[model samples]
Target: MTDYDIIIVGAGPAGLCAAIETGKEAKVLVLDRKQEIGCPKRCAEGLSLRWFKKMNLKPKKEWAVQEIKGAELYTPNGKSIKMKAKKAEGYVLERKIFEKELAIEAVKKGAKILMKNQVIGAEKKDNEIELIVEENKEKKKITCKIVIACDGVDSLTAKMLGLNTKLDLKETDSGYQYEMTGITGYDENLLHLFFGTDIAPRGYIWIFPKRKGTANVGIGIGAYEKETAKYYLDKWIKTQDGLKNGSIIEVNAGVIPVGGFLEKMQADNLLVAGDAGHMVDPIHGGGIGIAMEGGRLAGKHAIKAIKENKFSEKDLSEYTKEWYKLSGNDLKRRLKGRHLLEKLTNDDFNYLVDSINVEEALRIGNGTLTKKDKTILFTKKLITRPKLLKLMIEYARD
Candidate 1:
């Protein structure tokens, strides 16, 4: 048997971030099921640069494939609105390279990583947690003072800990993406989003440009939809001039839990971060940034608990408290906005686009509307459709 101060499952952004932080002051081990770190990419790979700055990390050119200056939103009727940021541009990354770099950074900070290893079971005994793992075709047990579950959406670690990891069909989104090259007639510096029932059902379609001639084209639909994501994606692609002749270089599919963060993320001697904890943004489906933030905060609090020699749920409550302080309210409001948007029809989307400019539309779509912005939008909606005032009031309360 081997032992370590901390053991993290998954080698994605969140797990590696936790390992890097915890390894600075304690023995840390990270386990991933993949033979190589960051294998089988499953993300759109679009992230804002602000997250990098927030973590005090620099964006490396090696993994950053393209810089995005702005985004365009398209309604079902083909009406379009464009929003451009003056600064803090987003980037399309090679996720495989980015995740590997994170793992490499964690390893450089004295963390040990076991690739091709998976945790099959976890149990709490005495003051430590024991993990049963299958490594290199051998079953082994390892003990650790604390365990951080950063596994993906279908997290066995969270389930083993007896946490409520259940996700309703409505709360999850089925997503599929294709990396296509030999594309033309696309603004390489702009990301595009198409919204409508026909385009993506209750969800949306996104085109995130990678290199000059390549882009990640994907569709995410609410799990209640009967059709598969690939079906909608293929149908939408046939109508796009740029992607009609594009050759698919890669295909990836995954699920995203858009239900906001879990109510509780910590139990006795254990903490859950990343998608496993449902840290995804319910409105935008952006989770990479939130995952890293959750991991860093969890790792920091874990170190504090280690120093105090206290691992009870009460002692670890600080992680949940601090994490909510960081993003709790924002996520709640976003979830409310998402629910409200789902009630809108294609005509409603078209009306919204025709009524507002790019900046105002973006503010509404991104759920960053100020109180004054809300009041104005509400007044306009009330004037146009009196029945919607009740729903607007409900959304405002959220």
Candidate 2:
């Protein structure tokens, strides 16, 4: 039996970040079911340096794989468009090193980290929560005034508390990824994205280079009936030109929730952050940055509530406000954008691709899109396909 001021479950980026922040002021306990930190990595490991600066954290050299300069977009018909970054873009992180670094930082700040502790469930009573953990076939209970469930998507801890953890069908996505070692002819600084019905019906395929000769190629598809992520990924790997010859080193399957925000993320004595709260970006299905943002807010809010001796739903509402302010509006806009993408038919996609090429050519010839350019592009796209324009209008309104 151990009494701690705060207990954080899960040792992912979000959980480790929470421990690092809260441990500065309180007796924090960080628990992970895994035997070692950063094992069984599932992330695509893509992050921008701008976020690191905004959060006041420096990037450790050992954790960064490569610096990305831009992203290349490929339409369904194999036509490509490269969007060169204007600034130092992002990084392909070595997640194993990244996760361990955060854990070590938390430990240095006086947080007690308990590895191999599997949290079975939790019990809330008298304004406090007791965590039931099992390690080495022995049962132990951790009592704490605050519990932050930084567990990844579909968190059992949030469900055990009877919280609202449902994701809408349209807002949910299934992911399949592979890390390859023998791939060649890949640009370390440029990531590639494939879009179309065959590649991904409602989503897209991504090729993110991790190192000089290695890359993480993956695809995310909307969760639909009788349509599995594995099936599509297997088919795409074989047919897609870029990945047809690459050897698969490792494969991972995961789900991302892109639906709007959950109704309630905080309870009497518990707070949920990161994927447990479904905070991933709706358009790109990226969760690393959003999870870090959520964890940062949760840490700050939890400290405020604990210091005031008031851990209520009202007190934790501040966390939700800060989260929305940081990324909620973007999530809302992207959710609508995802819907528009889903409504596009094969013909609509072809038309849109051609329209983009024409627009790009015009932009290249002139500096940027002028009023006449906008009018010409808009009229051509609208007259050619009314439904696509309708969908675009819907997203614009959102």
Q: Per-residue lDDT for 1-398 in model 1, tens only?
A: 23998899999889999988988898899998888776687689888877877777777788888889888888899877777777648888888999889998899999999988999999999999999999777999999988999988878997897677777778899999999999888788889889998889889999899988899999888988978999999998999998999999999999998874578889989898988888888887878888998888889988998899898888888898888889766787678788988888888778767876666665765677788877787886556865556666676664
* Pairs with backbone N, CA or C atoms under 3 Å apart (clashes), candidate 1: none
lDDT of model 1 at position 58? 76
Write the residue-wise lDDT of candidate 2 on 203-287 in tens digits: 8888899887788888888878367877887887787555678788887778889765786788777788888888887777888
Q: What is the lDDT of residue 257 in candidate 2?
A: 90
Please tell me which predicted candidate would have the highest lDDT against the true structure.
1
TM for every model, in the order presented, reads 0.96, 0.91
| Root mean square deviation (Cα) for candidate 1 | 1.6
Off by over 4 Å in 2: 240-242, 357-380
C-alpha RMSD between model 2 and the true structure: 3.6
lDDT of candidate 2 at residue 35, scale 0 to 100: 85
Error of 1 at 266 (Å): 0.3
